[model samples]
Target: MKVDASAGGSSQERSAAKASDPTSADAADDAGAKPRAALQDELEKLDERLKKLYEPIEKIFEEKLKPGLAKLPTQAQIDAARAREGEAARAREAEPSRADLQPSRTTAQP
Candidate 1:
């Protein structure tokens, strides 16, 4: 196969000439800038959409969940309940055994 080096060289020269031309560079920049601007506009729109989507959820948390959470028992309430349970347990332990309440089977019958 015959390789045409001159054709490749001419194409490289054309590319270099295109790059060196200010008008061609400006056109290229304009071409790239359009898509970049569109992408940036799309990103800004998506950001607004995301904010809109999360706003209701954030409001629900603030209005409903926060108040519900606030109504829940505090650490002090939990500690008080635990103290009452402990006291009840101690009272149960202090009470007489079942055997103490029952009559002795070893007692003689008349």
Candidate 2:
């Protein structure tokens, strides 16, 4: 049965319509209860499973990898190395082009 959208009635009207419709009422009731609980339980299980799966990876990064990475050059050292490389690149660009050193060939008149 079609609902009166213009009436602006309470939700009771919608529920009443649903109650009268045996197929819809049963479907609505089923949707409201067991499936929702089951979905929540499934989500909780998945969350726990994901946590369990990542625990070892987290531990490896925290315990094994972090210390090794900590021993590497500090940020200041890295910035200094980058600055030296940039200076070298600028010096190379400032040098005279090799083509400028070559002798020019003059065209002969016929």
Candidate 3:
């Protein structure tokens, strides 16, 4: 019990020492300011980098990708493929298998 009391008393003293020191407040303020300033600088750098990077990608999409997709598959090509598929389905249906015409036979069970 006495050991526990001393341990608690030391923690209270440590906190009191920190609260009494003016340099501790300055340290906390410096720590907070440094990270926020670094983050603001990084954010500005990333903003400029992303803007430069996206401009070429936007040009490639508008100039190349859009024109390529427009040239693919006219109306005549689609109609021809559909007509060929219809003829193949008709041919397969005209020839029915002999097994398909057979009837099932089952015995009665107890």
23-75 in candidate 2: lDDT tens per residue?
A: 68565686669878999999999999999999999999999999999999999
Residue runs of model 3 more than 4 Å from their true location after superposition: 1-30, 73-110
Instruction: Please report the candidate that would top TM-score against the real structure.
Output: 1
The superposed Cα distance between candidate 2 and the true structure at residue 86, in angstroms, equals 8.1
| Candidates, ranked, TM-score | 1, 2, 3
- Give the per-residue lDDT digits (tens) of candidate 1, residues 1-110: 87544346688776666666656765579567889899999999999999999999999999999999999999999999999999999999999999999989999889
TM-score of each: 0.47, 0.46, 0.42
Q: lDDT, candidate 3, residue 56?
A: 99
Q: After TM-score superposition, what is the CA distance of residue 29 in candidate 2 from its true location, in Å?
A: 5.0
Model 3 lDDT tens row, 1-110: 33533236678776765655646775568566989899999999999999999999999999999899898988999999999999999998898877787765565768
Candidate 2 lDDT (Cα, 0 to 1): 0.84
By TM-score, how accurate is candidate 3? 0.42
User: Under the 3 Å rule for N, CA and C atoms, how many clashes does model 1 have?
Assistant: 0
